[model samples]
Target: MTPIKDTHPSASSAVESGAPGARVGNFRWVICGLLFFATMINYMDRQIIGVLKPQLSHELGWTDTGYANIVSAFQLAYACGYLFGGRLMDRFGVRRGLSWAAFLWSVAAVAHGLVRTVLGFSIARLGLGLAEGGNFPAAIKTVTEWFPLKERALATGVFNSASNIGAIVCPLTVPLLAAKFGWPAAFYITGALGLGWIVAWALLYDSPETHPRLSVAERAYIEEGRVVTTEAAAPWLSLLRFRAAWAYMIAGLLAGPVWWFYLFWLPDFLQKRYHLTLQQTGVRVGIVYTMAIVGSIGGGWLAAKLIGRGWSLNAARKTSLLVCAVCVTPVFFAASVENSWVTVALVGLAAAAHQGWSANLYTFVSDTMPKRAVSSVVGLGGFVSGIASMGNAQVVGYVVTKTGSYALIFAWASTMYLLSLLAIQILVPKLVDARENERRVVTDDGTSV
Candidate 1:
């Protein structure tokens, strides 16, 4: 992620040190690194459930429907939290809000070890969901604060890439940890990692305006060609009225289930489909996420290169998203294939395309919304996504229980991306920011920050 350049005289002067004209040096990279690690911790805690699902289900004597309901419980709470978490981030500012969120989820991750029954596990996962639901709202808000429009997609890509890291690490580590020490101990160790991150975040993170080492040139670059920093001061309710915001919301809702399906079910699916051992399942999931990391970064770079070539920001994003949309459609046919390696390749491509599409979609908010509303808008979208995911989880659970197969599930996963892309096209059709009067307005908004 590129640093934001100073725009105003105050911002410019703040970063200039010693010399008559000196750049503060870019610090956005530092912030991006912090966010990346935080995401790693977030996904690590979340992915443990998938990696341990077989063990957990068997140990707890739970059925597929029961496991699905447990997953649904997390999504249900996450949906509710997403509604409020973004607003909290906007009110409290990213540093404090994210730090608190990280701490909460960390505690919840540890709490997972305490649950022995399905009900107990469900409750613990719900807590984990509520706490983790804050992640994207806080991360995306920081991206808006630190990166310029030109590099926002790439910045988002870097921030999100950490999730792949988390996913990869969890499977590789969790299964082994569970084998050696038991599943509960794995939770304790992963939970502890987040505690260290909370301390690091408190020590390292500050807003762009307050960061000590931001370069004058960097700050200027960020503020240059900016559309909406001051809009953050506007009531977030103002953002609700914007049609463009709804476009993102609807797109998120349609697509959210597909991701949740992968996150919560992929390990179980792989295990059942191939009769793989837990360790093998972990490796497979790890490979998929590792590929996702590449996809996320590569996707962002591809779009930036297009923008650098004089493509409009909207054109670049749309083009990249469309590519991802097209690439993912092939996954639908993958389920019917007989070869295991071919199935892996097809699933990997679909997973990669999802990450690529995600990197661009997250940037879409920063591109269109004023900085102030970014988190809230993200939260709104998350809320809708969370709801769809909750319902989707339950439905999948029932389907899997009734059919004893995931063929239909994989088919849905493959096609959902294309459907979502179409929704985005029909709803948005263009990438321009909505008119100022049409944006969401915060009414009687009050916050700690």
Candidate 2:
């Protein structure tokens, strides 16, 4: 896909004059806020099932295999949804795509509460996964549109941290809600949050060119690094031919499953191995996700700092990702530990590392692709990730069922980040390539629109 071109009245003047005001606008930060809240809701809805796993198992007479099956169904559907949603967002634009995705997923979340049988739950989870899958592709694409290169990482970090909030909220709130109001009620509550966000989003967000509240300065600032025009959209074939797209997709396929595993099963792992009560597990789980928030922001800051100090964006982003990947090694050791607190600490550290890696990775996509194709590439990558996740889901489900433990799962988790690191390194060795025609469609203010 070709980059989204400048549509603002200042487009030609911004490119020709190199004036300071060419790229003015404040709408991006507001868009970022909307994305952040959406993520929070996305994650909360996704993880409610995880928090209620034990209760569901008891009530439904599910064995470990049965629970795993349901989880697998969600992942399976989610993987497919992401593949479709990403492309849809790229084709239709984020505003419409996200609105549809949110509505579908919110409906699915409520449907989750209505299921009575194993088959029913599986179907509901699949729908939820399908609907929720579009989130990252859309959000990351939005970030690329709204932010400059230097600020992209931090902006992505801020938006990505919402996942941690969702994770934290799921454990802290879902269980209590489930206990007091029943599991179905928990679904309804989370579903309602999505609807509220959808309404607010519809009312508040639009393209920078269209947003009325955007200050002249803010709009100019955002339009600075953009490279395409509204009237002459870039061809999708141009983006599809880029090697960078392949690199980003490979990275996503490798890492997506790792994150999905953590989101779907970590709480159950704590309960099964360490014998923690649901309430106790909830508190510890909250801590793990809380640490993830810290990592996301910190990792983003570090990468931006490295870029500022003359490091190549590739070097800076990959270095941070590799470090985070290595940190996951400790989790394998953590899983073998007998002490509950020590186990929590180690897993928590690993979770934080995952977030840090993810924060930079999200930025990495923005760095590699033109703004127009960001969502499209993200969609394609999400599709790859979705397929990869299916294998991971089935494997983890079968492993947990057969072994009756999370030990093997932890071992796989420990090595996943390292594998992703290698894939990123071997696949895309450079940050910028002159052969790729690194030309910025310069607006007069030195903005690359």
Q: Which of the numbered candidates is closest to the native, going by highest TM-score?
A: 1
TM-score of each predicted structure versus truth = 0.92, 0.90
lDDT string for model 2 (163-231, tens) is: 999999889987888778788999998899899999998999887667788765666666654555442
Q: Which ten residues in a row have the lowest lDDT in candidate 1?
A: 434-443
TM-score of 1: 0.92
- The TM-score between candidate 2 and the true structure equals 0.90
Tell me the lDDT of model 1 at 6: 29
Q: How many clashes (backbone atoms < 3 Å, residues ≥3 apart in a chain or on different chains) does model 2 have? A: 27
